[model samples]
Target: MNGVSLQGLRVFLAVVESGSVSGAGRALGISQPAVSGHLHSLEKRFGVALLDRDRPIAPTRAGEKLAGHARRVLAATRELEEEMVRQRAPGGTLAVGASTTPAETIVPGAVARLAAECPEVSPRVRVGDTEDTLAALLRREVEVALVGQEPEDARLEARFVEEDRLTAVVRTGDGKLPEVTVEELSRASFVLRERGSATRRAVERTLRAAGVEPKIAAEIGSNAAVAGAVAAGAGVGVLPERALPRSPGVEPLRVKGLGFTRPLVLVTERGRRLSPAASAFIEVCLNRDGR
Candidate 1:
């Protein structure tokens, strides 16, 4: 009824189920007099005789209907309590995906900065090629992605982190001079990154445009692996400059007519709001407001 408390409803239900005030009080951790008082208050508020006080307590028709509502109310209360606890929990784990180049370059730096900023949060970073990262994003396995190319899906929103340009890295003493034309480079043996990689896709387009078929020697997983293979004189590999280790064995070569650049994007699902920590990490990557 309008003025009856939840405790009053519990007492009424317990008394009906137990068939006696003393038994209901023991079940509810209250005295027999307290249980009787709550039952009386509930009946007075509803202006109805809810039970018969005889040898064994029994509920009237109105009490049965109120009991059904009380169960639903109790269930809803439990759900609300669980939801509130989940919201208040701190430092939830965040899952993220990245393409190889950006994963090697920016992700580690961003994660380090994020760790300093949000010490309580724990991060789980997954590395993949372009298509795999996008697949992870679409599947909701990762809350955010650092991708080599911008995502075109309407379900994703992206911010440009940096412009990524493809370069050919070769061994230093191999006598392969810098500034080779696209056609000549395409004719040479090439150690390409794996298929579905953004760097590989861009390099393939440039080779096709120059009307030359590239002889791909190998398809490697990480940028470091590709660079290592190239350093061992396997072949010139198409990769990002940031992926190359600062050593004498490796040197980046420029290719004429192969000036292709794709944007590195920080992407998240559309219409899904980010947590404060996730949003802050994205903002740091974007460097929005230059803070």
Candidate 2:
């Protein structure tokens, strides 16, 4: 404990979480030999085995205890640094990540509100799909993420921000149909968002629950692309009801028994301390009217 290094503790935790020395090295952007060396040094300092290097490695009891303490130590250190930064300078840059729906329809306004509310802070926003947004948060590419689904990672804290529902849409002039039943939707060709998209996931989950499999006509990554495909009569597509603009060529339809509502969440790494600008942006998001 006397000679234990903070870097060694971080390396150990990374190994435990990633389940392999190689994996930890990749995560920490280090070499496997370096990761092994750190683990060895920690074990030597403690005079005990820390990890059971089996297939899918696990930490020993003593290692688990150390991990808990390490997490606390790291969290406290981050908090202290953040406080110091705030005390030294009130203004800084805030990096924000958002999924498609919020990125396209909500984040710009939120950034504007943040600018007005916290005049000293500048906000930088990155847009991606739900999966990518969460990944950006994990990689520390952004301090906060606005995403469609609540993150399952215990290391992340998610706050409910807003709710959005998916609705079936088609080209206006080509269809007399205003609404679709589960069976009809299953039978119809569909233009869907790519696999990791929250809208696509929700729609697929709903369809599966109803014992229907969608016939996907095209897999589009962007909402605009999906909308365009639907308007071009490629197939029916699902989109956030609020995000679907009133296009003369596109008609939105209610899907019977397919009420897919997803929460928009603001996610931050649980043990990480946010910068002043990030904290101000979060406050702005929470207090903003109409979400």
What TM-score does each of the candidates earn?
0.66, 0.67
Best by TM-score: 2
Query: What is the TM-score (0 to 1) of candidate 2?
Result: 0.67
The local lDDT score (0 to 100) that residue 92 gets in candidate 2 is 76
lDDT per model vs. reference: 0.81, 0.85
Model 1, CA-based lDDT: 0.81
Which has the greatest lDDT? 2
Model 2: how far residue 2 lies from native, Å: 37
Candidate 1, residues 1-291: lDDT per residue as tens digits?
Answer: 468687887888898899999999999999999998998888889889988888599888998888889888877988999888766543568788998888888888788877877776678999999889988988999889998877778898888898987677787776466588766776678888888898888888777777878898888887788878888989887777766654346688877756767789998999987876677678668873354
Model 2 lowest lDDT segment of ten: 242-251
Q: Model 2 lDDT vs. the true structure?
A: 0.85
- As a whole number from 0 to 100, the lDDT of residue 101 in candidate 1 is 83
For model 1, the superposed segments whose C-alpha errors exceed 4 Å read: 1-90, 246-248, 288-291
